[model samples]
Structures are given as structure tokens and as C-alpha cells.
Target: MDTLITLIRWSIATYCLYFLLNNYISYFYGISLNDYYQWFMLPSKQAEIEKLPLIFSMILFLLSVVFLNLLLSSIQLKAFGNFETYIYLGNSSLYDAHYIKDGDSKVIVSQTATITYNSSFKNIGLTQNFVSNSSVTDGLGKPQSAISMGNLFASLVITFFFFIPMLGPVHALLSPMLAETYTAKGLNVFKYQWNDSFNALLALKGFSLAKWALSWVAILVLMIYCTFRFPLQQFGKRAMNLPSYIAANQLIEAVPVSIKPIYIERARKPGETQYFKRIETSRRNVTFRFDKDFAQSVYVTAIVDTENNNLIEDKITSHINSHGKMQLKITDDLGIQLVKY
Candidate 1:
């Protein structure tokens, strides 16, 4: 229980440090604070979150500075490193943090993660979710649209290129703070100690939770500002005006006169073993339409849904031949369907 509390405190503190800095200078830089903590916003304003007022923003910044200073001075930074090791979230990628103890079975194993999110469930099968609703449409496993899937892939790229690239320096800067924290706690510097300061750990844990809660409130205010002040006009002009633009502009031309070589893919949710299969058949719909601007080329999309898996994927190369040919490649083993996507 103490280890869990420690991990939560460390994660909250790190997230806050990232969130606070992003929210603070964003006002002066004319950048949106929503970019970092948009997930902290209300559901309606998530995509359109905005800026913060200078006065309120300054207050939050000062508070974060004070809290961070206290945490660093108290050796909470080392506590954080120990907490990371405790939770198995450690890595040499961030810092060369080596905490070694002999003859201990428990060891921190560092691993990374990939985040995937689907915004809508447009083509998802009805059976995917136990109960379907208006907001999410279908269930958790529902496949994503091409554009939404693009966003998911974009997020992965950002995690690697943006976060990974910056974390090294950030980790290095924060590492020195551990010395002050150690001195305050009067701990052995040469040999690390643990499980001795219950009261101090509890106090830091409470404060970290409080700090995290207030950060969410600030995020909510910024989101409201963003939603109302969003530059929708410019986005609509460049990205596409949706149903409105469809009515105003010429209709999509050179639509697929005919489609051939109908291909179907089906599968059940994966089981403990790869060979496991369900008795029921699976259904899928592959759809296509010419691009709004380009008449000759149409974008192809496939909605893959089942009791076990839901996914939206596209072909790497989608060029209908000059002779109006639809080339769909399939395999005998239905599991091949899972591999293609």
C-alpha cells in the first residue's frame, strides 16, 4: 500500500511539473496550454481547449514552483526515483539511476508503452459493445475512422520523437535535487535506505494529491476558454467544412462505378492461446469513395469488428488502376486478416 501511494505521488508530481510549465509560459508564447493537458478538460471541450488568464496562470505557476522546491529539498526526487523503481517503471533512458541491493528478489524492470485512442465508433459492429450509447456509439473494441486512426498514430510518433527526446535533459536537471532531499531526510548517501520514514512519506503523499487535484481545476478553466475561442473558421476552410461544405461544393465525382473481388475478414477476440477460435462468423465492411478534391483517386477504408477485436485500418498503397480496377488481396487463414491491418 505504501509503494502504491509512493508511485501515485511520484507520477502526480511529474505530471504536474510537466503540466504546470506547459500551462505557464504558454500564455506569453501565444501557445495553448490545452495541448498538454487537454485530457484533463471536460469531454465536450477536449479537442478545442484554450489558454489561461495571466493572473490565475501566474498564481498556479508560483504554487507549482513552491511545491516543487519543497519536494526537491525534502529528497522527494530520490523518493520519486525509488518510487519509480518500486513500481517497475524505471529506465536508463531518463537517467542513469542505479539502485542496487544484494540478495533481493524484487527488482525494477523498465518497460515502455504505446497509447492508442479512438475518438468515434462510426462503422463499429453492433455486437462489439454490450451496450451502445450516443456519446461513444459502440463498445471499447470498436474500430476507428481513418482520420481518427491517424491521430492515434500521430500520438505514438509524438511520444517517441517529442517526449523521449526531451525527457533525458529533464531527468538530468531534476537528479541533483535528490542530494538536497537526502540531506533533509538525514539518510545514508553511500548506501540507500528505505521503509524507515513513514510520517514524512505520508505528509508528502497528501500534498502531492492536493497539488494534483488543483491542477485539474485549472485545466478545466483553460479548456472552457479554448472551446469558446477556438478558430473554427480557419480550420473549416482548410480541413473541410463537413456537411456544410458538401452542400455548397460540387458533389464527389468519378465514384466507384463497380467493385470486384469482394474480400471478407473475421475473427474472435484473442484467447490465452493463438490457435483458439470462436464458433460464430465475423462480418466486415470495406468502403471507398473518391476524394473531395481529386476525382480519379478514392480513399479505401475497412472497418474490422468482432466480439473480440475492433479496428479500422487502411492499405499502405491505395491507387485504383487506370482501368477502374479494384484489387483486394486476401488469404485463406482468416487470422491473416489480423496481420494485414
Candidate 2:
């Protein structure tokens, strides 16, 4: 039994080490079969067999945990005991003073004595001696083989019945995003020459270099697809529909303000110059924008009617001037703009 247990423990450890190495080496360039299948194939596959890698990975992880627990239990049994239990006493006086006399005490015989230092101390003068046993017991009541096998079978059943059903959404809904992100990052690594020494760090033998590179690409692709389906596609749709939601929230009586005399001219630099004549009006509220990019500062001034003449004051705030793209909204007393820089 001990020999068999040692073998199982060694096997489980070996399996875990290899699993870790495979996962690590496979993702060195940030991609894999799991990623490719998840991003490209899993979303399209209507069959379970096509989605086996993810499901198998989950099952293997679960089995590893169970095997680890068995291995730990065996080690604990060797150090401590096979089965262990302790009778907890309500009071220490009853357990320590009279019930448990001294050395090699095995059992405690007591009628329950309450100990209270603040109020009163009641001693039932517990009649029998308390004893402690160090002998090991098989908590599972079976050989290590039987217990290990039983747990392995239970875990397998759980994987099929519970985990398999949830694998599809997890793969379809999550993997694409991660796949895309990793793939982009890996490609960017080559572009920016970031982590340039990554290849040199790994001493690739035979066909491993190509295999590793391909694996990383596969993983990245899967992550990209997952992200796209769950967040990116939805984000694009929501962003495109935001204008309608904003329009619906406004009052119908709100007057439409037009930006006048808009002219766009190219600048000497990359960005262009936008020229427009500001509409001088007596109203305190007004909005303005340029059809083309503005290379220099533009000004909007409010013309207020005074005693006899119009008093012109700069209505532009520092907030609107600091952006590359802006939509200014001037409400009676408030100035707001939708800006992108």
C-alpha cells in the first residue's frame, strides 16, 4: 500500500510539473491551440468533441487537485494519523483539573462542570479519568488505493456532469478577447522590438522554436475572438446608438444652434487650421465649432447689451481650448462640450 501510494504521489507530481512546463513553454510567445480553437473554431463548432481541449483542461485540473489532496492525506497520515477526532470540552476546569489526572490520560469521565472566574466556579468533581489516544485510525475506513480511486471517479463524474456544460460559454464568451489582446501584444512586441531577447533566453531544440511560436499565435487569436464577441462588438453597437439616446433625453423646445461661416484650411504641420467668423449676438448663450481641424486658438465672445453700447466679453473657458476635437454646448449659464483629444 505504501509503495503504491508513493508511486501515485510521484506520478501526480510529475503530471503537474509537465503540465506547468507545457503551459509555460507553449505561451512563451503568448499564443496556443487552445487560443486558436477558442477564438476561431469553438464559436462555430456545434459539437462537444470539437471543444474537448478546454473541457479536458478543466477536468485535468480538477483531477490534479483531487490527486494532490490524496497525496497530502497520505503524507499527513504518515506524520499524524489516518483518522483523527477530538472530544471538545465546554470548560477547561472539568477537563484539566479532575477528569484528566496526568500523564498518559486516555479518556475523560465528567458530568459537565461550569467554570466562571468572574461570577462563581462550580465543580461537579467529575468522577472518571480523561484519556487521550495517539493510535492512528483510517478515517475513510479503507485502503489508500480504494480512497484514491473513489475520489478520482467522483471527480470525473463531477467534471462530466457539472463542468462540461459551462465550458462553451466560457470559451465562446471570454477566450476571444484574451486571444486578440495577446496576439496584438505579441505582434507589437516584434514591431517595437520589445522583449527582443525572448528568443535568445530559450534554448530551442529541433522543431520546438516553430512549435512554440505557433502555439503563442494560437492562444492570442483565441483571446481576441473571445473579447470581440463579449465586449468589442457590443461596445461598437452601443457607441453607435448613443446619439439617439442623447437626442431622446432632450426637451423638444430646445432650439437648434448653428455654427456659421465654417471654413477649413490645411496648416503647414500635420493638423490643419480652421477659420470661422464668430456670430456676434446679444444672447448670453451660443455654441461654435469648426468643420476642419484647428491649428491655432479660436475665440468666442458674448456681446451683452449695456446702457447704450454692446459690451463684448470672452465667453470661452480654459476647458474648451485644451482639446484637439470639441463640441461646445452653451446653456444659459453653463458651458459644456463633448470633447475628444
C-alpha TM-score for every candidate: 0.22, 0.21
lDDT of 2 by residue, 241-327 (tens): 112212222321111122222223433544534444344443332233222222211122222232232322121233234423334
Residue-by-residue lDDT tens digits, candidate 1, 189-208: 41332112222232443533
Model 1 worst lDDT run, 10 consecutive residues: 123-132
Q: lDDT of each model, Cα atoms only?
A: 0.31, 0.33
Strongest candidate by TM-score: 1
For candidate 1, the lDDT comes to 0.31
In model 2, the runs with Cα more than 4 Å from the true position are 1-50, 82-178, 186-341
